[model samples]
Target: MNIFDNDSEVLQIGALTIENGTDSVILSGDVEITKTQAGKAQAQALLDFAQALCAVFDELDSQGLPATADKDPSKVVMVNNPFE
Candidate 1:
């Protein structure tokens, strides 16, 4: 008999385990499609977040450095709560 026969009432999709019970399909795992429109939007949001983080770090580095015509080798400085 085929696995899709009346007696068989379950299906697996990637990491998901779906059970076709008397009145419902029970999903046992989260499902994600990396190529779907929603997935692409999520990826783009993540990329934007990463770029924002990099920009913050760059700003902190610039703020900590001094603008001088000559480099000084004897100045000792400490930065506190750069984000604040």
Candidate 2:
């Protein structure tokens, strides 16, 4: 599934998709990740989560899905999050 915006790079997630009103942020590609309670989590939690996510992407890619998700994809940094 993919969502394309003119000039804005397309976001494609294997067979996974995101629609309007999902309360998610497109960090990169077609992966829409939701913010977690990092404040309450351990210091390594975020890193652990990222590793797990990468693993998932790898698995998905092996299953014929693309692994293009990233925290920073050389995208234009938004001055502010519209959702906020």
> Which structure among the candidates has the greatest TM-score?
1
| Model 1 per-residue lDDT tens digits across residues 1-84 | 122124456555446565644323355875465898877865665455447546655775687834543546577677798789
The runs of at least 3 residues in candidate 1 whose Cα sits more than 4 Å from the true structure, single-residue gaps closed, are: 1-33, 65-84
Residue 64, candidate 2: Cα error in Å is 0.7
Question: What are the lDDT scores of the predictions, listed in order?
Answer: 0.54, 0.42
Clashes of each: 0, 0
Estimated TM-score for each candidate: 0.37, 0.30
Q: Which stretches of candidate 2 lie over 4 Å from their true place?
A: 1-41, 66-84
Worst ten in a row by lDDT for model 2: 1-10
lDDT of 2 by residue, 1-84 (tens): 122212333223433333322222244333333455443343344355456556755765677864453555577665877788
